[model samples]
Target chain A: MQTPNTYRAGPDPDGHFGLYGGRYVAETLMPLVLAVEEAYNAANADPAFKAELDYYLKYYVGRPSPLFLAERLTRHFGGAKIYLKREELNHTGAHKINNVLGQVLLARRMGKRRIIAETGAGQHGVATATACALFDLPCVVYMGATDIARQQPNVFRMKLLGAEVVPVHSGTATLKDALNDALRDWVAHVDDTFYVIGTVAGPHPYPAMVRDFQCVIGDETRSQLHEAEGRLPDTLVACIGGGSNAMGLFHPFLDDPSVRMIGVEAGGSGIATGKHAASLNGGLPGVLHGNRTYLLQDDDGQIIDAHSISAGLDYPGIGPEHSWLNDLGRVEYVSITDREALDAFQLCSKLEGIIPALEPAHALAHVAKIAPALPRDHLLVMNMCGRGDKDIFAVADHLGVKL
Target chain B: MRERGYWLALAMSRIEKRFAALKAESRAGLIAYLVAGDPDLDTSTKLFEGVAAAGADLIEIGMPFSDPMADGPVIQAGGLRALQNGMTLRKTLALVRHLRARDADTPYVLMGYYNPIYRYGAEAFAEDAAAAGIDGLIIVDLPPEEERELADPAERAGLDLVRLATPTSDEHRLPTIVKRASGFVYYVAIAGITGTRSADADNVHRAVSQLRRFTDLPIAVGFGIKTPEQAAEVAKAADAAVVGTALVDRLAQNLDSAGKPKPGLVDAVLADIAALASGIRTVRK
Candidate 1:
């Protein structure tokens, strides 16, 4: 019933991406959300703001991260040529810094002295803490109690950067609970605190604003691929949790009909077993964290805890824009189980000497499946969005390595 | 137009009547909230009846969710207990119907998040809730901007959808909220979650006065009016004062070491309600 181009311009003035995204929060947060919308709009149009963002992205966070050709991976697949967009080389060792720098600058411009964020794997928390330290702003990061225990290194990283890491014990003690606590903190301290939402989710201005900040990945990839391959790649792949990295890599290429987009979701044990974080593949659309998105919930509409070996992908919901994209048929969403992701983690490490995070290992698993069936001339770009240094202990434990 | 007016009047009459009676007595109405199946359903039902008998002008039954973001630890624990006791949306409506059979005059509001009703199907939920004699609803997560998903159906079913106004709701946004809001305006006395901090009476009075300038809708102050003294302070300015966490805490306090209801759990909660009711009544004296 709709054209292919219908997916390009979404999230109308009211922030509804075809009934998926809207500001579904309490009245206590309405004014603050509106203020953020206004400030983001003004900053978006100001050339000076863009220039400053560019400066930080290039000098501080290290932009234009190399597009490394994974020749061994291509040979192992025995099909398409594979290229890895090395976002793992960024300052914070992940793609999270790209958006954090932009948001911290915007928060500074708005005269906010305190920064608060919620994290699952500690990658976003580390990135946000890094930005806050650079900007001289006091920072607080909320992490789940379970995550704090599992992700001790990230907890230490946040503390080393002078940010307080509060362990949330409410609900399932996961990313969703952490986000709820952060929103509560924001509501209580709206006057002085800026909530740096880690993903491309949350209410209006958040999903869109975060995507705009992250689209640099796709923007760079378009030119880099053209210069290297003489044309756009046939397919793009990235893992989806709150879906920031996937949205970043998918937004600028939405209009390129020749380039297909595939978002990989963590299937945990498996989608069939019901213990998974594959929101689009195994869940339904419902409201949570201030927006309507695909959420893992019971039949009674109570949210269920998402399970994944990777902390970053252990979230019950995905981004609202991903919901819109899935509904519009512009992007294909698939799932990979925990076993498959772990296998890919080892395979990628052995084949390319690139230790991919469990989050992107889901994407690698899917790529391994589909790439082998495609023609050799076909080009596939997968976002190596995060490094696996933080995941070594978990992976080792799972593999009986006794790290 | 006349039919619309009739529906609006009929939908609003229960809330209006309670406020009118309180006005005649020169006191604020007491709104009591209880999780539907705290500890167990039959006990919560008994507690609800006791609250009405103890002089609560209106009642709010919380449909417990897995995650209650707006609630404090006391209320969240109550919700978890209710869920563990097998409290579901259908059972909550059944509980309301049972209560309605006993007392028909008290305004009953179902307060919680929106997902349960969304899963129940909005139109079906409205029909069933209206059939169950539910007077109103206060979904904490469904703001005015996203109300149409449930508001239109609720209105057609002759159920009032109350809106919450907080300290952050400035003058620029009050008009839009007041226009569509029915039943009453729930003013969160504190900027924080339920039961965290008590509201300053003077600040509450100023906020209520500001809201009064926009709409004639009765203002019911909630969120941190925990004790009798706090309720008395809020009663001076607001038409009604809502108490949730204090009553929930009473139920928790009366429980045994194993979390089971002790002998006087219902009585203890009712006695607290009676004290709060008497406290609000002192605004007249």
Candidate 2:
């Protein structure tokens, strides 16, 4: 496949980002999926849709999330300047709400009466539930039973937000099964329900649509960095599970040849230990959850269970566009161990006075490694995608505390 | 100019041959479906023979996948049971070869998602499946738009790539779906997954009549077929009625505490298939 002159012109009319993404759903949902593509494209062209989304994002979602200089962390590393895109400070405490509001608005525009979503750590579920509450739509969230147990607070948050949380006890009872259950629900209720896929994954129109909604993060960073540093940043880093946050941050800078970008995957233990969620590092290209991407699957094409300390990163496959970009060698894909992320979590909490979620801590861990090697003038940005308030219990338990 | 649908009527694939024969006999076919290695290899192995002997005109063997979102809870459990019993695509193909060693006349269609076959390498899988005496394939997730991945290889290997026409397939989408499909089209009786709702007879009649306008391929109705009466209703308008979850549920009822099949498990499942066959045979389509 010939590389396009511009990196952003992807996911052609049939939803193929160079054979990595397509609608691989059952025939019962094919028309609905196609309708979603049509609806999203129409929504993109309408100024009213953008104005409504901007209105909600600025007021309800609290957009334009600040980009702060981590001066103490930079001093600790004693190398290149470091900046944190404080997505954790947003309403619902993560970057998930940005895409949720956009999708819920699209659903409303299409006259869908119900909202459904799948979540691993419940961040997306909470975000969806909050948006549904604001929009007065009935929300259904499918979460793995195991995730419900581990992330009790976020599950409770979703319930309090008036969403019915269905626990999926299917194979492995994790994010993949939750995704399976969500797709099943969508197939069953295609007429009234609109499925708000959490990340930059799923059947077409979703990866592209979600990334377009999330480009605000990178778009802000580009102009914000230029204002602060008077030039484009040298390097960009963010962790990936289904890879929405990283895609949002990396996509805006993809054409800038001088800006080096890296996607940090969750190496649960380490690659050598054979227990990790690093799809790009230890997996191959395959199909799962409606898209063909890099998946952790066995020899017989059965999806293998992915492991990570961060529940948000506990998915067997990465998004299709990420897989395509990885193939194009446009963005560097790497891994960070759980132990490294844990240390980085504590270091950011102590030095920067802002605790980070375990998901972004993986990106911060990568930042810690490369920060010391560069000169002081080199600007680096890491997406602080979520706060650690929801992760305190898990972190405390991991540290042998009686939390 | 000769129309494309005219050429579609001339192709006599193996499964199509069985449907035509059933039509000539003035009886709609009973297409029984079961996971390849449900419960255990011994029990599922017995089931392949039992259903064939129970007067099932055509058979649809489900290849178990870890995430079968298109199926309901009962079929999902059945697939999980088969996978737990160490069933893989290669093992399922081996099971088909085993079935062929005894009964070569029964038309077999391997039905499942696409990932497993993709992992086995599509070309090798197509050739191997044809060699194993499998007649057709119904990959639930491989839509017509994405047929380029497996279409050529399945054609090269002489295996019928059966297409599923659902209620969600609009008029504009109907021609595109059946244009490339070789075997009898499997018309899903309902918009939902398998075993959830009893397919409304009026809806099935309407959907089947609409499908008749597109192509001459024999239509086999499946999904939401729970009872012999429901099977008979579906068979009245379509060429065949596929009863899967009802039979899988009966098989599940006969399993012992240890997940093994009990003494009469094989006979019970075969008897249900025979009951459904008799029901479909009662209807003159």
Candidate 3:
């Protein structure tokens, strides 16, 4: 096990990600966002706050998840050595709980009584609901009607955790609609509600805050790779929805120029077919849901609805940091179609008994394509963001293997 | 009516004259909905002219946001269709500027959500919308408490912040909603989505009557109003009737067989809108 590296940098001074992010929100919410920023800046510097969070990580949520080297998986793909950061070992079976614990703890310190969030695959909602239950704060989860029907198990878990689940029925009834509803709720109750935004998307503090909490992934991965192989991995890969888990695992490796980082996004069919969620591939520069990122939009700037077998990655926009990283050449984004992700999902499951989430399966698919070309001496670290229990139905339906 | 001098004054003097004429009319005002650019830039100019000529008192040009939440499936589909046909805010504003060259009186209201406007910056958007002959704006997602963000810039640009009020607005909030609203107070008939369907006239009348007691400004009832009879029922109690999804959906439905081109659909929709307005007045009388 390697120690966590705590290095903090950000939004330049005006909450901007290399001209990609700014406080583009209603004025009524600006003061609140500014307050949260100020609070985060103050609390992060506080030794007592850091101690509290560190204690929880060690005792409560079980931090320092294992870094495993997959020998068979690497030889099968015929690519670089594969190392997996086992975030799936975390409580709640995904990387989502890591950030949720951080945000929910921050909400407690801020003296908030109500917590609200939006979820797509219900991973974040369940994580948030778990946090709220632990903290004894009221929790409300807004999920798109479509997602509620798809991710029924997670929805049930949230309800069992005593969170109110509001089904959003507008605009394709998916993640975007749930986001809109959550934003409306925040606006209406800004004074009382601390919106625990699930992903690194939203206006200002959210993207930065979520990234900060998630950056532990990168911090752990960096030290683990250095200790295990006597040097940092040559390449890193992770899936991008709103780019939370990818950013979490990518941030610490950012300054390591030799360690090439790749972010894989879901392409439902193909970019040419115009039915994919490849925001970084097929999208133009635009603002949606508070961040100015690459959005899958038409010529008129109307955001196009996205399609993905993985509900978690079914969004039309990527995180602002990903946009900035793409523009700065710090990261390269690749697309893995539904078929490709399915193939990787099965490959990982059969070879290593590691049933990867549909999201990470996209990254694994990208790795399958690129690994065969890289030298054997080069090592690749892929963030196993979540488990595949939530994706069995989608996989079975897509493969026509009646289960 | 005089309170709205801020946004109304920004309009060219001749255009202001046309707005005044509609204020005097007893015939339930013409409410027009146009997706900023339909067929192309050239077709937008024709659509504006056709609607104006067809007795449209107020034209609500859809400024095409990427994600329009308040819109019904019909309007959302229409907006996507328009966007696919090469419509943009820049092109939409250019259409407004183009319309100003010929007609100035029919009040042009750019309707959409806040993301596109915020992305453009409120001050810059207000300045550009004003320069392009847009008289007012109707951002659907902006709650009443947050109106000041757009209101200050719009006031400076001499454009109205056309706010929306729902049946659920409490007694205390009604006055504030009316206080901030200009041109007219859009009374959402129900507490649901935006679409075209028959609404209970008694329910609409009660909502409008309650709003009428709070503000003397024209209380226009809208949302899901489809037929002429429904329009007449809403018009009998409210000062104006605003129909959106039905007209936009009609254009969407009458598109070219291949779905690529929808030439002359705007004109046909405008004609139907004019008929709806006239039919409402005839039925009410």
Candidate 4:
């Protein structure tokens, strides 16, 4: 248990991040999962794979997105000088493209013909569809029916990219149900298919593979802040659904004991009302979707439906690495409510002239709470993980305004 | 004689007795599967009590979870109906106790995902399930690598921890799978979820033979045996043929428009089981 040497050496060789992650899938997929692991390990060691990923990230995903200081917002907070890592500027308008390119490339290298994925907010779906189109591979995405209704633009986008979007109608028709169907698809088609998991969850290699792909966010932020301020930032913050963007930003800074990290979860209405997506704050450890993590479930362990205004953040479980980091006290996990995120969404748009995604607005809400209390010299950076174009309809519906 | 001594030490578990009886009969067995509390608790209980009488050599009761990812549409709907009717792990165990009070010869295994048992407290669940007369467990989600917590507790309670060997399981992984398995090796005849496709007779034959090379336990072929023909084909390849989706489909066919069981649901399912049993009896391993 003590051999982490660093907070990043994790997942061990067997894909365990200290009991939080293991392959809990059915025996029918165990060999396939191991085969994927073997392929990923080989590709990870190959210089050509690294160079190819770098080429795609730099050209396709538009890597090294700007880290701009929000002067007006910082002055409004009157405390920490807030900076935003503008991941929303990336291709497909989210940090999800980072992982998509990495996974799709790996799928091709494994000689897989079809690509499959599951989506919650449609951002990952759109990203995967785009990558599959670029590679000219047949792609299928499983989305919850409720999500397709809310995130309609992304559905259209995926269809336009020549990807099939299948709506899952089971179990509250949400992200977890989409995941269940995607996994079922994998089991049925493991011979020629690859599953492009969007977030830092599911069974590892996935949690670790996704984190490594998205680590560009943190790696860039670290050097950018040092070049500007001559030292490490005091704090890093990001919103978490399955905790990919947060993991991306925090994993690079985990060994820096001087820096603090916070992952904000969605508090739909309130945690006490049993309607929130705050797994770490209000749930218990259990296995779901092939990994052990904090899951929102009843006493009988039936996965409870998660509620959030931001569909991206409405998952019942966090990434296993996030759960492990919470256990190690490496990153502080907190929750923000719908009203708080909505307010932050509007405030960030007006103050910084940046319309942020509802997912990152949760992180901004937490920043609003703490930034005012910190010293003026304190530096804080938050990941603006996605844009708000796909969310305007939901935002208007919540605002009681006709779109 | 040596196997009987081994059974004597464990008080002759029902699973062992059932397998021994099937061996003596020199024909493949039939396992009738049902989701506990489907449609309603009473109907499920009636069907549970009727399977053995109707000719089921073994019974498998599904402990319904909200998300049964490993099941096809029929069994998934069956589980949903059971969950809607207020079936929990506790209630399923109570049904087991009920089955034990009346019949002691028919061995039954509980099939489900691992979350419910993990939530029920694995140690407590194993002891409670064993006490309630459950013979074995086919937890689809908990592979051998992750079964240590529940396996130890289940073993201490004298429950058989059954393992599933799928078409995807290669020679290297077979040892790890059989090393921890106790009751029998469930050979998933296809590399897919339950009840979706029919197993190829040739593939089942080869896979069953391959499994025997490593494990001395009886082999049960499942996961796509939907018809009497398919069941008969699997019976020729393995020790038993498990027909879950077919029986569940029969129950579904008897249900009314609103998903409530009609008057003859029990009889229809039992008849289906009897038909499968007859078909399996036509073939010998």
Clashing pairs in 2: none
- Using TM-score as the yardstick, the better of models 1 and 3 is 1
What is the per-residue lDDT of model 4 for residues A1-403, given as tens digits with 9 covering 90 to 100? Answer: 3535689888987788997989999998888889889999999999999999999889888888999999999999999999999999999999999999999999999999999999999999999999999999999999999999999999999999999999999788999999999999999997999999999998868999999999999999999999999899999999999999999999989998999999999999999888899999999999999999999999999989999999999999999999998988888999999999999999999999899999999999999999999999999999999999999999989989996
- Root-mean-square deviation (CA) per prediction: 2.3, 2.9, 7.9, 1.7
DockQ for model 1 equals 0.76
Of 1 and 2, the candidate ahead on DockQ is 2
Provide the lowest-lDDT 10-residue window in model 2 chain B.
B5-14
Ranking by DockQ: 4, 2, 1, 3
Best by DockQ: 4
Candidate 3 lDDT, A1-403, residue by residue in tens: 2212322366766566765666555433545666778888888998988788777777876888888998888899786899988988788889998788888888878887899999999999989999888889999999999988888889999999999999988567899888877876765566678988888887788889889889889899888888898898899999999999999998887877687999999989998999999998998887677667788876545677889988999988888888988887778998999999999999999998999989999999999999899888889999999998988876787778787
What DockQ results for candidate 3?
0.13
**Model 2, residue A255: what's the lDDT?**
94
Q: How many backbone clashes does candidate 3 have?
A: 5
Instruction: Go through the candidates in order and give each one's DockQ.
Output: 0.76, 0.76, 0.13, 0.85
User: In candidate 2, what are the lDDT values of residues B125-186, reduced to their tens digit?
Assistant: 99999999999999999888787778899999999899989988889999889889787899
Please tell me which predicted candidate would have the highest lDDT against the true structure. Answer: 4
lDDT for each residue of candidate 4 in B1-285, tens digit (9 for 90 to 100): 577667574677889888988988889999888999997899999999999999999999999998888988889899999998899999999999999999977898999999999999999999999999999999999998789999999999999999999988889999999998898889888878888888899988999999999999999989888788888888887999898998888899999998888998998889888888999888864
Give the worst 10-residue stretch by lDDT in candidate 3 chain B. B11-20
Clashing pairs for predicted structure model 1, backbone only: none
